[model samples]
Each structure stands twice: as C-alpha cells, then as structure tokens.
Target: QQYLERLKNKQVVRFASQAPAHPLWPEIERVTLEQLQYARLGVEGGVWQLFAEDGEMKMYKREEEVDGLAVDPLKAVHTVKGVTGREMTHYFFSPDVRFEWETTLEQMKVLETIADDTLVILQIHKRVWPASQRDALFWSHVRRVPNDTDRDAQDIWIACNHSTEHHEAPSNEGKMVRVALTVCLVCQTSIEPPADGGPVTRDHLTCKITYCSVVNPGGWVPTSALRAVYKREYPKFLKRFTQYVKDRCDKQPILF
Candidate 1:
C-alpha cells in the first residue's frame, strides 16, 4: 500500500522528443529488447546450463568475452512462495525497497524518469577485494507481457536494466571503476485452486523468476578477479533477494 500510494502521487518525469540523441539510448533499447526476448524464451534453448542449485533456486552462466574483457552471461531460475509476478516486479523495481535486500549496493539514485515505468539509475557498489569500487548507470524499465503460450495464464512481469551513459554522469572518470551491464528480472505467477474450495491463500501460489545479466567491467581488471567476484556475488545476490521478498510478503497481505 505504501508503494502504491507513493507511485500514485509521484510526478512522472518528462523527456525531450530528441532524447534518442543520447549516446546510450540506442544501446539501451537494443539490450532491453534483446533481454525481453531471452526472458520470454527462458532457459529453453539449452544454451544456459545449471551451474549451481540450492533447493528451488538454480543458477546458470555461460562464459563469453568482449575485446579480451570477460563478459559472462548469467541466468538463474527460482520459485518463491506466496507472491504474484506483479508484486515481485514491483518490489524489485521500486527504489524504496532496493536497499533492504541488495547487500552490495553502496549507493543508488534515480537520474531521470523517462516514463512511469522507466527510469535512468545510477548505482555505486561496494568494492570487492583487490578491485576498485564500481559504479553503474543504467536505464530500468518494467512492464507486463502477455502469455501467448497460455492465453488463460496471468501475464508475465519483467524489469529490465541496461547500462547507459549521460554527460551529467560520465563513467570511468572518477574514483569508481565503471561497469557496463544489462540485467533483466522476469517473474511469472502460478496459482493453484484449492481442492476443497477454501479461500485461496499464499500456499496456493508461487512466483517463478528468471534473472539474466551480463556485466563487463569498464577498465581492464584481471579476469581471474572478475570471475571470482561473480562466482561469489551472483548466487548470494539471488538468495538474499528471494528471501527478502518471502519475508516481506509473509508479513503483509497478499498483493496479487
């Protein structure tokens, strides 16, 4: 309720018609659309392998490179109890609750609101050992996508974040090492009807989540250090985030 009220009252940010002239606009759009495609298909093509699994959560990663820089693509699938896709996406997209669950986030701010469902964000992450502090500038967008495969199913919700650039917040010029990344969080809700026709409760529902990310540290960092950071951070991040949602949702009324 607090989140819904705040969003209702907050003023939407406007953008110029020539906003496309921004250097990162094209790349942002391209990455966002590409991520949406991957999110829709999920881990279906066998391109993503299950690298780690903890209970209901499974993490996958594919090794790739860009100009000698290590660019690893990651995908994770998990099921959380007692939440809908809308609720999960809302909490993830909302800045109000991000700091609560994102342990590595040192600082975050919204640079601009392109629309009600889209915004440009600037975030500085805590420094890992042997590596400098890192900052990311990205455009985040959230929306509900129709489930064509099952017309009767609820729509899938997605929150996509892609690294971008703006003159006001230049990258790699400051103390923090700039990191380029594209991240997507997709959620699909599943609800089972009670056999006895009792009132539907959280026990009858689950939210399936698909998370994909490709992070490229801007300056030359040792590939070994980068891989180590990812190996530790990715799994921990997912577990913390899901547990955060489960705890919060359990305390409040279901927001379906």
Candidate 2:
C-alpha cells in the first residue's frame, strides 16, 4: 500500500508538441491515445507475455530428453509510456536468453524508480544541445550516430575526433591513429578509444561496441576493420574495437 501510494505521487513531466498545420487540426488519433494508456498499464503491472513461436512443437512434455526435443523461443517486450522520456523495453528469448532479460528488466525498474533520470542526464550533458534534441540520443545515441537522422556521417566523424582530441592528445600524441569510425541513428560521429585507455568516459558516448550491432547498418561497419593495430599496443581501442568497421555511407536520410 505504501509503495503504491508513492508510485501514484511520482510525477513525470510530459511534453506536448505543437499542432501540425493540417486539416486534422489537433491530429492526435484516438488509437494512439489508447496505445499509450495500454503501455502505461503494461509498465505498472510488469505484465509480460510468455509466448512461444512454434507452440507445442518448440517444447517437450518433459525436460530430460535434451537431445530429442526442439527448442522453444520467446520474446519479452514491454513499454514505459506516460513517463517522460522513457523508452520501450524488449527481450528476445532464444535457446538460453535469460540473463539479458533479467538485466534488461532490472534496467527498466531502475528507470521507473528514477522517473527523471533521463531528463537529468540530458540536462547535465556536456554538449551544447537544444532542449528538443533528436530522439535517437534518448536511447543509444553515440552507438546509433552513423546513420542518425540529424547529423551526417562526416559531421559525426568530426565530432568524434573533437570529443576526444582534448583529453587524448596530451597523452597519446603520435601514438593515436584513426583506427575505426561509425555513425549511428542517434548522431553522426563516434570514434573508438586509442590503443591505450578504454573509451575516456561513459558520458553517454562510449557505448559498448558489441551493442553497436543493434544500430542501423547503413552507415556503420563491423569493428573488425581495426585489424592492423596490434591488441597490446592499443589495449583501450582493441578492447572496444574488437569488431569495428570503417564506413558511414550506408545511412539513408531520415524523413519526418
């Protein structure tokens, strides 16, 4: 009862966009509002569907026959609507995709508790960005920069070099080389750390490279492009650039 009371009092600031200059006037569809309400309920109940793709064929009646039975696959997806700046959550359950769901749910719970965590993060962001900054930044901005809607691939590259130039130059000098680069759906340029230090800081930009796979593939490359640089010499870069790529031509312009 106490926890429920506290949740009721949790106020998240919501933003209202300006009306589009169209015949529809307020243009807000009823179905959209219903979807938002359903999403809110989903988050409140922690109501997740336990579904399988292949139905009965995907599973066995008993657990012992590991060799004879087919595997069942499931997806755990939820949404956090009504809360300002919260993103939807999704989990794919393959043969043994368990820990990722636990970790993802834990993250969602953390977001739910903080309420204003994303807003505070945006407020403290080091970049001189506008209040209405692009939405991709809300999720995995740096990782998605290669094919980002707002910034171009070249623009992203410049930002990457500019971001780390101040901190890395004094220490790495000639040792630093352009090993790998990528743009994402959130913003344009993100560079891997040099052979020395792991990405200078986690300040929203240093997304783990493995997760880069989630980003749109149009403008980005796999991290393997930094192959020439030996691992020991560039431990930091090597650590993150294990599968790095070196192109940003794949992204298409975003409309809307």
Candidate 3:
C-alpha cells in the first residue's frame, strides 16, 4: 500500500533535451549494430548454441553469468506468415497495443517520448510464482537499416530496449524487484512476387524475426527458477506477440 502510494504520488520527469544529444546515443547505436550481427550469427549457427525448439521457433542461450546472477543471454529466431518486417516492428514498438498482446505485463507507462523513434517506458510485470513482482525502466529505440548484402532485399527493422535510470523511479529501493535488461527484436521481410502478376497478398510475405534478451534480476533469486521462467516465458511471449500481429494485420490493409 505504501509502495503504491509512493508510486502514485511520484512526479513524472521529462528528459527530452537529454535524449537528442544524449551521451548514450552512441552506445545505443553500437549495441543495435551488435545485436544485428548477433541475430545474423544466430541464423548461421556456430554461435548461440541451441537449447530448445518449439514449432518453427528455435531458442538458444549463451553460457555465462554476471555477478552471481543468471545473465545468460537468449536468442530466438522464427518465421511468421502473413506479415512484413515493417508491420511486425510497428506493432512491437508501439506501446498503445502492447497490453492486448503482452500477457505478463501488469502496467506500463511511457515516461517520456525521447524522439519520434525513441522512448522511455516504465513497466511492471506480473509476478511469476516463487519470484517477486518485477518492474523495469527502459529506453526503447526502433530503426530500419539497409540490407547491403542484397541491395534488392527489403530493409531490416529493429527495436532495442535497454534499462536506464530515472530520478523519480529509483530501483531496488521499492517493494518490487528491479530488473536490468537489454532486449532487441530484429525483423526481415521476405516477399515472393506472384507468377500470375496478381496483387501481392499476406500469403506472399513472411517476417523472419530474431529476439535477444539479457535480463539481470536485481536481488538474488535461484538460478534454476530464473531459467525455468525464461524457458516458459520467452517462447510464449514471442509466439503470442507474432500471432497478435498476424491477426490484427489480417483485419487491416497490409502495412509495408
């Protein structure tokens, strides 16, 4: 109750000016590029040793830890039908439609619109049994990069979300456990033109998606439990999110 009151009364601070020329912009861009490279490596194999498979999705986790916390990085790649990279990325990056698809999200607030393509968000996630409720504050950026390999190929779209600090929302001082996380979603569109010269439809396009996340649960929790949650949540999250995009896009005109 006290925590909730503090949260409700906490003033929201805007850091618009800091974002445009923010010192973190360079790091964000560098990390984005690195995630792109990692995504490609995931597809090519030899890295990101596979751990689990579900239907069309293959999940992989690197062998590493940070400060006795399970910082095991995760990467998953899957192909979803009836969607383009642009359409999938739009839905993933937009917070307006997040609650409709994200099952674990309890509450989400946009703290600031840093830029047209950048934003700071605060989110509380529902408690998974044996673990305390978790909250995250992060900056998210979405971009489209040219595909240099195949000049004729569709542009790649990516959304990166990394944990950041805010004066109003101090971490580890509240009742909810803070989560330090960096997540990226990369999408590439594959389009096959019709032999009959017909209008391109949903069936002719697919989005190859790569999702990577490294979450450091603040405060110690059993590593086994954390891994269990990831094994269950990651695939479910991806599958549901993709299906949500596919269903919504089916009702509207094709985007990109």
Candidate 4:
C-alpha cells in the first residue's frame, strides 16, 4: 500500500521476485568468464550496437504500421541486448541524410538507433506537428508518410534541431550558389527577387549564383548585378553558368 501511494506520482519501480523456476537452473550454477564473452559481444554487435555503430543498418523488410508500434524486431531484443522477450522498448534506425528533433522522454524512448552526432538532414511535413508534440501513435504513423519537404527548411531545421551547423552544403559549390538563388520561402533572403538596387525583374535580374563565398561572406551583392549575370551571359559562359546553378540548386526556384 505504501509503495502504491508513492508510485502514484512515479513512472516506474522494481519489485522483488522468487528464484528461477527453470529445471536447468541447478545444472549450470557456475559459468566461466569465457562463456560470458559471447554474451557481451552479442550485445555490442546487437541492436543497440547497430544503433550506436557508424554507417547505415540495412532494412530487409517492414510492415507499414500506424505509429511505429511494431517496427523493432522481436528476435533482436533477447538475442542482442540480453533483454528477455517481454514488452521491451522499440527503436528505429534512420539514415544520416534525414533525421528530426524529438522532445520528451517518451518520444525519445521509442528510438532504438539514433544517437548524437549522427549525420542527419532535416525534412518538414505540414500534416503533423513537431516531434515534440506527437504521441506514440503519431510517431508510428510518421514512418509511413513519404518525407518530401523543401531542402532549405530541412537545412535550417536540422541545424537548429541538432544545435549544430552542417559545414558542407548539398554540393561542393559552397552555400549561397550551392542552392539556387531564389526568394527564400522561409527567410525571404534572396538576391534575384530585387532587394533595393535600381531596376530588378524576373527576366532582367542578375544571376544570384555566387560561386565564391556563401553570398557576401561580409558584404551583400548588389541586386542589379545579381540579376544581370543570368540575363546577359555569353554563349560559352551561359552553358557553364546554367550547369553550375543546375548542379547545386535543390528545388526549382519559386518565381515571384
């Protein structure tokens, strides 16, 4: 009764139980340390290890469940972590290319794989709220949905989520030109959209492609020149210029 009252506000508590009932329990009372090595390595190579291990863990198959309730493989728990086949926590592995922020212990608990410093890119979807707000049901459903969001949003959100900056852009071309110069949907930071220097339009705007620094490391490019490069380019440079932006720009620019 005292325990129950205390546990009313607590999440979990352990209780004592009788000894093992197995008929073989008395047969092997003492095992050597060598017998324990396999047990230890198995855990290190098992699911949790796979989760902490570098690189990707291959996904052989999956059932499209509602809220990831059934993603973790059952056989893995006992075989890997020495966790008996009971109601153990489930975890899922995602590539470094895409991952998101998740708040709360419950949200973090379902995860069996993701750890800190994992290289993940961000992806946003409109139908749901941030991972912080979702329940187990929503998290399960999350795996089923196709992740297709603006890379820029993904970029900013991931940086913020991890509280770390991604040094490399989508390509080696640097940040600004790395992504196509267009009116940024999230921040409204764009060079081609005409930001205060004389005449600027879609057809007569300078090429917002800054090959060097990520757009004025310390200085902003004039809007006029930003538009001029795209409009007035020699045939030789036109192909090269087009390819540079084409190679780096992620999604097509939103015309304004």
The candidate that wins on TM-score is 3
Which candidate order results from sorting by TM-score in descending order? 3, 1, 2, 4
TM for every model, in the order presented, reads 0.85, 0.17, 0.87, 0.13
**Candidate 3 TM-score to native:** 0.87
Give the per-residue lDDT digits (tens) of candidate 4, residues 28-127: 1222122222222333433332211112111111121223222221111111111111101111122221222221112222232122312223222121
Clashes of each: 0, 25, 0, 15
CA shift at 133, candidate 2, in angstroms?
Answer: 37
Off by over 4 Å in 4: 12-90, 93-138, 141-256
Off by over 4 Å in 1: 1-31, 42-46
lDDT of each: 0.82, 0.20, 0.84, 0.21
Clashing pairs in 1: none
Tens digits of lDDT, candidate 1, 73-189: 998889988888888888788888999989889999999877666778999998887778889998887777778889999888888888777667987477988888889999999
* Candidate 2: Cα lDDT at 72: 18
Best candidate per lDDT, number? 3
- By summed lDDT, which 10 consecutive residues of candidate 1 come out lowest? 11-20
Show the lowest summed lDDT stretch of 10 residues, model 3.
11-20
State model 2's lDDT. Answer: 0.20
- Which 10-residue span in candidate 2 carries the lowest summed lDDT? 84-93
